[model samples]
Target: MIPPATAPLFLEQAGWPHAAIVPLAGDASFRRYFRVIEGGRRAVLMDAPPPTEDPRPFIAIAEHLCQQGFAAPAILARDLNEGLVLIEDFGDLRLKEYLEDQPGEELAVYARAIDLLADLHQRPVADVPPYDRAVYLREAGLLTEWYAPATGLVVDAPAYVAAWEAVLPLVEQGSAPVVTVLRDYHAENIMLIDRPEAKGFNAHGLGLLDFQDALAGHPAYDLVSLLQDARRDVPAETEAAMLAHYKAVATPGADFDAAYAILGAQRNAKIIGIFTRLWKRDGKARYLSYMPRMWGLLERDLAHPALAPVADWFAANIPADKRHDALVAFAPE
Candidate 1:
């Protein structure tokens, strides 16, 4: 939390005369945010902890996307030295909440979301940093670190390492045209707003949020992140239709279902590690409730014939029945 004395300094700097600051909800990071409203116009204020959270990427990406004609939160002002920023608030109706009342129209809503994603993926990949192998391995490695300790099972780290190593050649060979992949482009990060001012069905489609972490990554990665969302149960048929929609827009090329499965397996493995870490390291056990759903997604992804080696390694090393128990221990009761 910023001291009351310091709040005046930021308000003065941003030129929002006599700004009244109110705390906004935050996620699992050290960063803090507040909603600042004055004279009926609203904006969000970010209080990022320097040395832990960097504001440069958010600034750079916001500017780049704004130039490229995407709907990103507009940057109103910034004090980089103090890690403070004022941004246009995209409003508060998350897609997760929107889908709840209108469950029957979920697929239609997702189709529109996919259209936006296709537009993002069509952009040149070179404009952003590569979502390289080192980061991939490091994310996957957390599985052994967190899951093993939480479960009290000594994971065969070497076998796990080898499994991921074997996956690399396949990933490289299966690489599709790169794009500015929204690293966490699932339902939670999307906001649904009324399109009172626009003239189309998708006018109120979505408001992108928490996209500061966006980076260049495989096109298939975000698709899996959306279709195979661990928190919500997306039907197999709906998943197939969305995949078809994406493939239709993509340049003529080999169908990348195999690569998609591989990436999903990789992603799910990393998420299990994250859920475990959240429970054990941060003591935020509420996330543990989602572990079974995550594992279920991982198993479904691994079921694809293309990921045989990765699936086989998991089957041979990790006992099926015990997995859920280990995951729940770290979850809040």
Candidate 2:
């Protein structure tokens, strides 16, 4: 990471008269963000590590999405040489924080978020690459390599792999129209910006972020991202209602319930592995604490008769007793 003073200096050298660089919270990526408020206007400053974290692809994708009439931050300045970019600032309140304070209107806010997702999924991006089988398998492998070791369990490798592999058929069968999905369109990535002119669901405009991994894939995948959140508890009834709301606007042939079940299964499977890997490789146990909640999500989805076979398979193999032990082993102290 570059020093704060050097970041502004680099911006100055790049011909921006001056910049006010204040760091923004980032997750487990090499990317860092700063809100640059200068001339009474706000812009986000991205400091991406070029050697390990390339920004070009993300930048290009954001621009293409903007052209397609989506809410992507406009690029104000770029220093490709330094892997730094200046973009329009969306504001401070993330959807997660916003929802925490707006308990009375939580479902309503999620309704709008889902509306944005519907628009996102409706856009065609034929040229964008799809997340094929190799990627799916690779992600699953992370759990085996990282989480299993962290939990001190000689994870049944074949069982773990098969656990996720078991769902692939369902994944393919449940595919929706392929579109550019903001792969991580969760509450944490959204910003609540003030826009009075925007009406109806647009009462408070949404700011999108961490969309660099956007890919052409299943439409309902992101819906699952928001609805079946690993971090928070979303009610089953609320989940059903949100599914219905999305279905009301989705295209013909898109089976909202089936897609939701498959996506819920798919995402939870990936997260199980992610939480495991986070503990083992990064020595971060905080994520491990969320596994039970995630397991609960998988349990909920498996209740769908369509997913019963996979559910039964997991229960028969993983066993609730072993799962309880696994959770107790690595969860944060």
* RMSD (Å) of each candidate, 1 decimal: 2.6, 3.2
After superposition, candidate 2 runs with Cα above 4 Å error? 1-6, 13-15, 159-166, 173-175, 196-204, 252-255, 321-333
- Report lDDT (Cα) of residue 242, candidate 2: 86
Residue pairs that clash (backbone atoms under 3 angstroms), model 1:
none
User: Per-residue lDDT for 213-247 in model 2, tens only?
Assistant: 87777777788888888777777777778878888
Each model's lDDT comes to 0.76, 0.70
Using TM-score as the measure, which candidate wins? 1
